[model samples]
Target: MKNILKVLRAERDWSQAVLGEKLNVSRQTINALEKGRYDPSLPLAFKISRLFERAIEEIFEDDKGEENA
Candidate 1:
C-alpha cells in the first residue's frame, strides 16, 4: 500500500518516534509505514485515521490499482 503518512507527519512536524508514540507502536513500525515496506492492519489503519482525523482512504491508497472501482 502507498500512503501519505510521511507528508502528514511532516505537516504536523512530527518525527517517526512521535507518530509511533501516538499510535502505540514502535518507531520502526512508523518507518515501515512511511516507506511502504508494510501495510497497516485494519485496526492500526483505523488508529491512524482517527489520529489524523482523515479517512483511511484519504491517507492510504490501493497501490495494486483501483481497477475494482
Candidate 2:
C-alpha cells in the first residue's frame, strides 16, 4: 500500500521518532510505514486517522485497489 505518512509528518514538522512516540510504535515501524515496507493493523490505522484528523483513505491507499486490500 501507498500512504502519505511522510508528507503528513513533514507538514507538521514531525520526525519519524516523534510520530512513533505519538502512536506508541517504534521509530522503525514508522519508517517502514512511510517507506511502504509495512502495513499497519486496523487499530493502528484508526489511531493514525484520528491523530491526523483524516479519514483512513486519505492517509493510506490500497494500491492494489481491492477494497482495503
TM-score of each: 0.93, 0.93
Tell me, what's the RMSD of every candidate?
1.1, 2.3
Error of 1 at 41 (Å): 0.4
Q: On residues 1-69, what C-alpha lDDT tens digit does candidate 2 reach at each position?
A: 799999999999999999999999999999999999999999999999999999999999887788655
CA error at residue 43 for candidate 1, angstroms: 0.4
lDDT of 1 by residue, 7-68 (tens): 99999999999999999999999999998999999999999999999999999999676777
Alpha-carbon runs more than 4 Å astray in model 1 = 65-69
* Predicted structure 1: clash tally: 0
Instruction: List the candidate 2 regions with Cα displacement exceeding 4 Å.
Output: 66-69
- Cα lDDT for residue 43, candidate 1: 100
Model 2 residue 31 CA deviation (Å) reads 0.2
lDDT of 2 at 21: 100
Alpha carbon lDDT of each predicted model? 0.96, 0.96
Quote the lDDT for 32 in model 1: 95
Instruction: Give each model's clash number.
Output: 0, 0
